[model samples]
Target: MDRRLPVAVSFMAATIVAVLALPLELQLAVLITTPSAILWMGRTTVQHARAKEDNLRRISEIEQTINEIAGEELLLFQSRHPNRAETVGGRTGMSAVFATTLNSLLMLLVCVALFGGKHGLTAQILYFVFITAIALDLIMGAVQLNRYVYRRPPMILLEK
Candidate 1:
């Protein structure tokens, strides 16, 4: 649902612009679809940003918890279970990757939609910038998740 909303809006915007940008002088279509595109892009970008922030926050809390656990407890866990790290890695990495991929694909869709189907090269630049923001947000989340999930020597370590 979250992912689909942005895609649908982008497609609709692209269709409107393509259809209206004709020499038919449909300025009304521009007035209508331009703001609609902006609104959709604005709302989707905010939603994506918030979701990315939330996921990063979770990863940070888990990392902090790991940092707090120390000494024999950490050692025992590490020794007895080698794959625990991978499980944590999968959990954090997967979430980040999922969000990133979703955002990236959406951005790509918007880009091509604008260029290939919509108002030529003019609006393409703006859409690119708009969609790029969401991509960056996704990247931010992935970086945070990686830092948390792949800390060297593990965030939680045994005190010698």
Candidate 2:
């Protein structure tokens, strides 16, 4: 409803550019960047909305009962205790950052690809590479999200 219309328009505009433009390279450039721009917009819209919702919920609940409290002194005492914060995966605030940053990079590559597509075969190959990378990044995110929700096992993060 709210999300789908913009996405559709983005792709359609890209298609129009491809058909209307006479030069193959410029057309290819439009083809490359158009959908990425559209998808980037869509993903950004949804994630930011969700993050705002979560933030609002946390703010509103901060002053509430906080799960059957006895007294103010008890609450104050418990707040000083050590709480172990375990970040299980790279799925927190970083996901959006990773997505956005990569897209920005790819968007540049997409422009580079247009020049390559027009001038040499290498550029076309590079264009595909950029698109493939974007797709793979998204797929990996889905897999990670699934693993997080299921809690299948103790997944280890191997740091280099």
Best of the candidates, lDDT: 1
What TM-score fits each model? 0.36, 0.42
- TM-score of model 1 vs. true structure: 0.36
Reference-based lDDT, each prediction = 0.49, 0.47
Q: In model 2, how many backbone clashes occur? A: 0
lDDT of 2 at 32: 65
> Which residue pairs show backbone clashes in model 2?
none
Q: Tell me how far the alpha carbon of residue 15 in candidate 2 is from the true structure, in angstroms, after superposition.
A: 4.0
For model 2, what is the C-alpha lDDT against the true structure?
Answer: 0.47
Tens-digit lDDT track of model 1 for 13-51: 565557535653464344334544544544444445445
User: Residue-wise lDDT of candidate 2 within 98-131, one digit each (tens)?
Assistant: 4444544454444554445454688667666776
Q: After superposing candidate 1 on the true structure, give the runs of residues whose Cα lies further than 4 Å from its correct spot.
A: 1-80, 86-107, 114-117, 149-160
Cα error, candidate 1, residue 147 (Å): 0.6
